[model samples]
Target: MKRISSIFCVALIGCLLQGCEKKIDLELKTTTPIIVVDGRVTNSSSEGSVVALSYTKTVKSDNSIVPLTGATVTIQEGNGTVYSLPEVSNGVYRNASLTGIVGKTYHLTVVANGQTLTSSSTMPTMVAFDSLVAEDFPGFGKTIKVVTPFYNDPPGYGNQYNLSIIKNGKLIKDVFAYDDLFIDGKKATFPLIYSRKADEFKKGDLIEVVMNCIDHANYKYWFSFSQSSTGSPQAVPDNPISNINGRAIGVFGAVTFQKRSIVIQ
Candidate 1:
């Protein structure tokens, strides 16, 4: 098992990048319907987890972190236990004594003004690596369309991921997926893509891919990060969800969400 992991996903963007119009019609202002509070835990270990909460910027506004000054955040454990989390800092809640143990269930709730938002699921055991294979797209082998396939044991959510291409143990290129997305009101985890970034990888090299997943807020931030990253677009798979199990619920981040992970293949 690798010491760390990463998740891959996409976010719903409002404003256009480079002033180019894209998804401009899908605008959800603060007064529209819901407020999405993305809470994903990345950089975690047996020691502790540092989770983050983020939101898509207000439509037509610059990319800025929304101030969650008075918002109340709470986490619920399995067996219907509840604990209120004080804001450790801006948009962050730290449970110094709380550690994410595999197999135990957890739920998060954030209340602001007169609104309440919640989601929950159990954590999965850590996943091990598979392999990263590089192949050229049909009719485009030595040129334009080179495809890199990253596979891992238990090819699904809750498992962590990161990609590394090494030359003589020297770092060549690495990619990490931010696997936090609202699929049917649950948190989803997936793999990352990094073929186009490095110009020096081939079929005989050791190319490793990393993967993992976190909460919705972390998912959205990573989604935005990927969109704003300086490279070609790599899209992550979205989970199937209902109104009750969505990340972006009524006037909140999302409604229905499954935090658990499973094997895909």
Candidate 2:
């Protein structure tokens, strides 16, 4: 019986050793997305003061931004001041319309699940608009190539234009669609980017763009209409776009897209 007991102990030790070796062979690590919070205090910001927060996307695929369902963001200012931002939407936080002054120091804190993070940037002297301009977006094998220069789009609040593409009063459909660009300079030309599309228009398609200013909120309303994929143009009927005349606090680069009808070599 004693000999049998010894054999049983040896079997148990062998099993324990094998389990330890398997665990030693296994290796694991993790990578967590970085969370970012940006706060801006502008002099003439319509909403007063606001905060925009974002998170890192998936490294391999373009569609991966983790949702901010239960994230909490808070801002604290100098002089022992603390403010709670309202979660306007998923991951978007807004602050009360407080006039932000120059030289005031502010900091932001973010907490999601158990992870915590922080970031801060002082508000620079505010810059106002000169006017938003739309010009021909060159490059990217656009319609008529570089020879056809895009002109300044007239000012309007919304996206409708009382304009015509006339080469000698003949209406031409040179305008393809809106395309935004991030120039090498890294500034978002921040314009309603557009360009002539290949095949959509002919060579030397003389096109003219015209529009008057509508409302400051026209772009947002029009975008929603576009997303619905409505075949018709009127996105928001109430904000009927009329005159296309206005200037911008700054210039905007136009957007462009490749005309599928025209094939490239």
Candidate 3:
């Protein structure tokens, strides 16, 4: 989740800002390599689906990731339609014509190094927001404009949402997810959190907020990921609860998205 990444980035920036000259050596423990898969299928016909493959490294390594190549990846629809994704470059497997439809289940299969990994997710219905507005929040040294999106929760249980904020065509490093546990079948006004540098929106900047209707499994994946990544005291420092089987780390998400944009005034 973006929240987890944002927290890590803030901590790293703080350490750099401290201007410490002393180099501290840490005895990093070596661990076995695990396959990381970030695969997604959306309802947008113009957008292609991709499955990125890579191997994790130790903390003491040179911080370079080795891409997993020559792998076979395929996605199967619930109606028995299977599409194969070929390796293009940079360890990425993509299929340009495979578009997900709402209320349909999608299954992902990967074969690499004699190992097979698979996961399934169902695409939920798309929920469009009613409106979007920018609200000014007075801070210590600056005024921050937080984007607020308004939407009505559909009359049903098990509804989950994921908000993605884009500034000037670039996605911001902050994850926003919500569930209608208490406010089911009600109008919801969710405000975006802007606590870090990467989350701040400026005047005259183009901002787009994308709301995704995700299933319960995808919601749990992201919620647990955000908690574990942020080093929450309640959560143990381990890999987020993965939906993928066969020791792979990452998620296979099938989502429906509705987006709206506004230029900051």
- The C-alpha lDDT values of all candidates are 0.39, 0.34, 0.73
Best by TM-score: 3
Measured against the true structure, the TM-scores of the candidates, in listed sequence, are 0.45, 0.40, 0.79
Tens-digit lDDT track of model 2 for 1-265: 2124223433444365443211111011213443333344433344445555444332222324444656676666655577777788876677656545554555556666676555333343222212323244444554222222223333321122112233334534322222111121122223232233432334544444332221212222232223332212311112221111121010111111111111111
Q: Rank the candidates by TM-score, best first.
A: 3, 1, 2
Q: For residues 6-109, write the lDDT of model 3, one tens digit per residue.
A: 34433544366434221222234757666777788888876668898987664344435678999999999996989999998978999989989998999999
lDDT of 1 by residue, 1-265 (tens): 0112222232232222213211122243543432434353322543233234445444333434454556777776677656666777876665655555556667767766666656654555554333333453433245332324333344344332223333434543333333422232233323223454344444455443324433333333333333332221111112212111233421111111112212121
RMSD value for candidate 3? 9.9
CA shift at 206, candidate 3, in angstroms?
A: 1.6
What is the TM-score (0 to 1) of candidate 1?
A: 0.45
Give the Å shift of residue 107 in candidate 1: 1.3
Ranking of all candidate structures by their lDDT, best first: 3, 1, 2
Error of 3 at 223 (Å): 0.9
> Where does candidate 2 stray beyond 4 Å?
1-33, 36-39, 52-57, 143-265
Model 3, runs deviating above 4 Å? 1-30, 58-65, 138-142, 230-238
